[model samples]
Target: MGDHQIVENAPTRAWVLHPDIRNFGGSGDERPRDPARALEEAVSLAHALPGLEVVGNEVVRLPKPHPGLLFGTGKIEELKARLEANKIELVLIDGPVSPVQQRNLEKAWGVKLLDRTGLILEIFSDRAATREGVLQVEMAALSYQRTRLVRAWTHLERQRGGLGFVGGPGETQIEADRRAIDEQLVRLRRQLAKVVKTRDLHRKARAKVPYPIVALVGYTNAGKSTLFNRLTGAEVMAKDMLFATLDPTMRRVKLPEGGPEVILSDTVGFISDLPTELVAAFRATLEEVLAANLIVHVRDISHPESEEQAADVRAILASLGVVEDTPQIEVWNKIDLLADPTARLNAAARSDDIVALSAITGQGMDDFLTEVSHRLTGLRTEEDMTLTFAQGKQRAWLHEQGVVESEEQIDEGFALTVKWTETQKRRFAAL
Candidate 1:
């Protein structure tokens, strides 16, 4: 019924991509870059996909990058052969291929060829269950499709009935449709601007409540939803799939030690080679991460490309001006899948700002919460302060707001000892 609620509809498919060109960026790590790892990651993403199956996959080794098609002629032939051999009807490229390249590749392969951008867009399109999310996806899709119109509307010599036909057959139906879609995109942008203003107003209202927003950001299918559900007790869509969530969901979560409730926001997950079009389109959604007071960088500890994916998320966040300066708690999720858990723990400990936890099994959740508590409250030591019944207001405030570490009955009056925030301490002092 609400945008926060998950939509239980839609069928999706996991298409295969040629592993040879699966490059997002250079990793400084000396570990060998395995393309099989990319394919495995892609399969993991498919697990979270509802009503979808990765029926097949294939990789094409091209001679070099061609300006128009990205792959050379001989490699294109090999690609065709592989597609036929594998009975694969759809191909996905894990790199940023231009619209021209996409069209040319599809023509050469004789099947749907989706570049990294296109695949991401398709996932975004399906994940966009809300009206605003749909608007954002549509805006991005239109921007992407505008350049590929030549493939879908090649026959431009049939215009006749339109009043603007004076411009000749070149000004055809397809061109008019493109113009109309452009106009619609303008309207959609305006509408989304209004929605953004509304979200801004809501954010300001939230600020008055004084809850720090801790956003979970990482590569897609990194168990962010599962972690969010575990922390908030909200049954969000959590599966072993990619891009399962497109809309940002926020919920109030209680701290382990009865501390102040914090706003935990689960945003749309990031990917290794995210499309620029989707990035620009979903900038409004990602603004949540930028505005958050704290960020939890959730990583799939079991993923082979976990380090690389972490780097990708970090790079994207830096590009968005959301760097390490913000209070960041790296959460290494899915530790249950690891054979040597302590090794993973040691790896996480190396970061000094990281917490190892398995969202599925509730392992290390307590330690993770403690780490978050330290980051948020900066509570170094527990203090026991005595207050008299004469300070009835202060006692009541402590009972209502602060966590009572200890209580005692003094000679003259009731002595209540409690733990409070720094601001709460200042308020208490003023009282």
Candidate 2:
């Protein structure tokens, strides 16, 4: 509500609930997430919001969601009594809740209610720092609010008088509010277009250089930011909380010898059932992953639901249109959390596409870096080229890339021997 509300002195008492559905009808072949782990994730999400004290959390097993209210009468009464006893000011549901259901539950429990989407939106609104990030979150929130206009505002039931020429009697307040939201969305889209154009120009400028982009992606709290900070030595916020890093961060990193320079990108973490509005709104920001030469998927190797979390991350990446050809490596992070040394060592030696490491304690970092360097070097190709005196820009670019091993001055121009990757060669050719 009102973008985000910040409480200064007192934190709001909140309770988290994760609805564990037994059967998903005829949906895709995806397995339902573990209930216990889902409850933990929900609690973490509640903790991510500032000034929210998560007093309690539980996994509520339901065969199917009730139409009028998400929970049955008995369950609702039980939870209402518990919430009253605990003095919870807010209830956070870890799954979708219909507008009618949400309203009914709120009335019954005598507290504010936030479904999964709303809670995620609040977190994004509070964490957004950059101008683009803020705009995207607002746009997404507006879109979500537009759909819930039926029960979102109390004034929606009021009718405004209008001239006979315009309408028979008048328009409802909800209609006017929807119109206003539409106008706001249009304005935001225009501003976002200009921002996107500027970002595209910046991307083109980066393309002139020979540095390859390596983007990190994974589920929330999977150690992507930690690994990014460790690799780039940047002070990006790296915490054990969900969605801690909302804005994408990029830094130029020099690889080991025989490896070309790379631009490392730390992106917002993905979560299971991320709102569709957010997915569409954040597409511009996620283009960094689309343009990447390599994607490193960081995973919390020690988590109980690590594989399930990995599946969720992969699903989101696929939804984002990540191509099959893009080289990907899975970093099994938080190996230090594993109690068994043999298991850690075995996980580290698993496969070519997998590298086990601990971003916090710096264990297995060398192996991770070595694998990255090896993969990047594998894309290199040596080439011989001649640049005429008229092609001063190309000559300068080749030299700037540090790819020119030898150069000779000819009568007409310069002859250079360059060992570069296919990407670098194409960029130089374009120049």
Candidate 3:
């Protein structure tokens, strides 16, 4: 929102491009995204924004990216002609573009440009509804803008001469702008720290209750909010749009048949090529996942890119440091959109792990709930410990967590039997 796009009276005509670079990353396991699917996703991203008409899109094959310009002079001229013919006012590139390349490309095509990171930032800025979410997005945008100051703002290169009585020379406009952004970032970080502290307090309060937290995480628009609403009956925005839910939403749900009472969290959906700036910005928003006792990796099994999307989610989870031992259930969601959902469900049922169902139709919800209860109840492990009189605090903590089952008076202080989760055990160890 800061410098991503300008407000216009009418829908701005936009075109999407995916630069398909060969041998990208060059690592042993690294490979470029599927060009066709990547282009489709870029188009979808463009469509998610308001007041913009994506007039056309293409996958531009690139042997290698040009340094000054992303595309070769020949391809640039060709695309420029196409954009001119279509009256495109904005160009959306489906990958990271260096600031220099961005400016040069915009100048070449005679249009405003937003690369993958910028486009995502714009959407996040527009969709962020919470105070913390807004501040995080603004900070991310500012951080991104700071890197592009010299390239994005030609006018900011102006130098102001200092008076003889003052310092020898005044700072350049770029220096002033970068300093201003840095100051704003510092202020935002202070505000965000306060907000995060409050959230941490809330999380701590929740921890005191013996309820396990189950987090819904997956590729964006994979029906996380819909599934959450189906489970908890909370009306979170469940649009089909990408990033429909930015801030994490949590609700406490009591499973049917007197099952365990647990907290259900619906988090921001993951996506392929998630911007680097956002990963750091939204860490607090996603810290809930770190606290989760169980994670439900929801996947839109009906989509062609389901496997790819699932991989992306896993990659992000790994990057976020989600422990491997945490119990996770793979939810093959949106089966209603599939052609033969029953067959697919049958295949999934054969596996003790995956649960295939449509969140909208409520199919197999009972199984899902039962699986969740089983997993949560199964998380408890029994142990025996002898606490000294000096350890009254830890003993009290265990009792408060409802984990101390039986205590016997002993020489040290008390010998106790406890049933608790790994998370609780870890907390006790920390204490």
Candidate 4:
């Protein structure tokens, strides 16, 4: 079964939305979707969800700085009727709702309720596989949950593992659990700090090698991991689920025709309306992008919203201060899924350094690798020479420090053709 099919079977009813605060004249920015756009986006998100079915959904429209119920009384009543008629079990508001407002909405609807922040946290928690990633996700979740712990049943303030581990006598278990979660949050942050330090050391070491770091970044499920795997021979988890990869993975890959090895990094992908908490929590991990010698903005050429996705990625990168001076090459991936593949290829190839290729089929891999090799080596080449077999030390150093392209046996000695950087060439020149 496909990866998406596995998600499709999970049992849950998820309602989603994209709130347009611009309509309230918050900043005077015009939104084409407005409230109507939110409903459409919600339905689109619902349809993309795997396993658990969406029973019913309604986008709760809100004005700027909504005090209580985000929607007007009439709109709330309309949603109430729809929920009752449809027997909806959950109400998911597509924006951050305060704890009091969330509780009030749940009580009125007589159903569980979640805001966009909570939903995104749940998705991140579910998708995180590595220990470090899980710690980071849980840290973000606890930070979000802290504000929503106003009510007693919220179980937001109990510390476990002590005689009076629970909250005050009148407080419920939920309150105690929340407190425990908060304590765990502190511990997790310390652990992640250590991980960050280790990552920094790796970065320092990588700098000594002088290989250009090429980072693959784009919208979630934008074929980044696929392209990374294709380029680096790594088996990182690649799936259709959102946030499938939370931790960055780097591998040294030799480009085609035997150029020097380059460092390639696969990073967690971005989304259009990513939660603020997640962005803040993942910042430590995202520092990898800032140091990238080159960035590959990978896009799924087949997605209907590819342009929007690309714009979102650029916006996020610009926000993080990583795009100003760093060089970027747009990679339109998954052309195998598109009709008139050549047309798509031609379109992407317009950029000075763009390449269109199918990572799965190995199509255009040669052209793609050649471009990569050129970028990493800065348009340099090597010379061909022959040396006596007795030059054992020189031969070994050439093999170790430079890329040996071809070797042949001759009666006098050996014929060796190799590629090396300018520094390496100087080092070999003395020999």
List residue ranges in candidate 2 displaced over 4 A. 1-8, 25-30, 155-171, 256-259, 385-420, 423-431
| Per-prediction TM-score | 0.75, 0.85, 0.87, 0.71
lDDT values of the candidates? 0.74, 0.85, 0.87, 0.71
Ranking by TM-score: 3, 2, 1, 4
Which portions of model 1 miss their true places by more than 4 Å?
1-15, 19-33, 42-53, 81-87, 155-175, 347-352, 379-431
Worst 10 contiguous positions by lDDT, candidate 2: 154-163
User: For this target, which candidate reaches the highest TM-score against the unseen true structure?
Assistant: 3
lDDT per residue as tens, model 1, 1-431: 24235446633344666546433344535453576776666655544434655676655444346889787777778767866776665676766677677767777776666666666777788788766788999999888888777655432222223344454436466689799889989999899989888887787667556566789999888899999999999998886667777888889988988665789989888876566777788876778898676799999888877888899899989988885557788899999999888988987788868899999999999989988877777732357776666888877766654345678888867755565455457656887
Residue 345 in candidate 4 has what lDDT?
Answer: 77
lDDT of 3 at 9: 69
Question: Candidate 1 at residue 87, lDDT?
Answer: 63
Full-model lDDT, candidate 2? 0.85
Going through the candidates in order, what is the number of backbone clashes in each?
A: 6, 0, 0, 9
Number of the candidate with higher TM-score, 2 or 4? 2
What lDDT tens digits, residue by residue, belong to model 2 across residues 1-431?
35447666788999999988777554646677778988888899999999899999999988888889978899999999999999999999998888888878987987889999999999999998878899999999999888777666532222232323253324476799889999999999999889888988788778666677899999899999989999988989988789898887899999876677899999988888787877887776678998888899999988888888899889888988998777899999998888886776786586789998899999889888988998887876677778899999998877766677789999989988887777667788788
Model 3 worst lDDT run, 10 consecutive residues: 156-165
Question: What is the Å distance of residue 126 in model 4 from its true position?
Answer: 2.0
Query: Roughly what TM-score does model 4 have, to 2 decimal places?
Result: 0.71
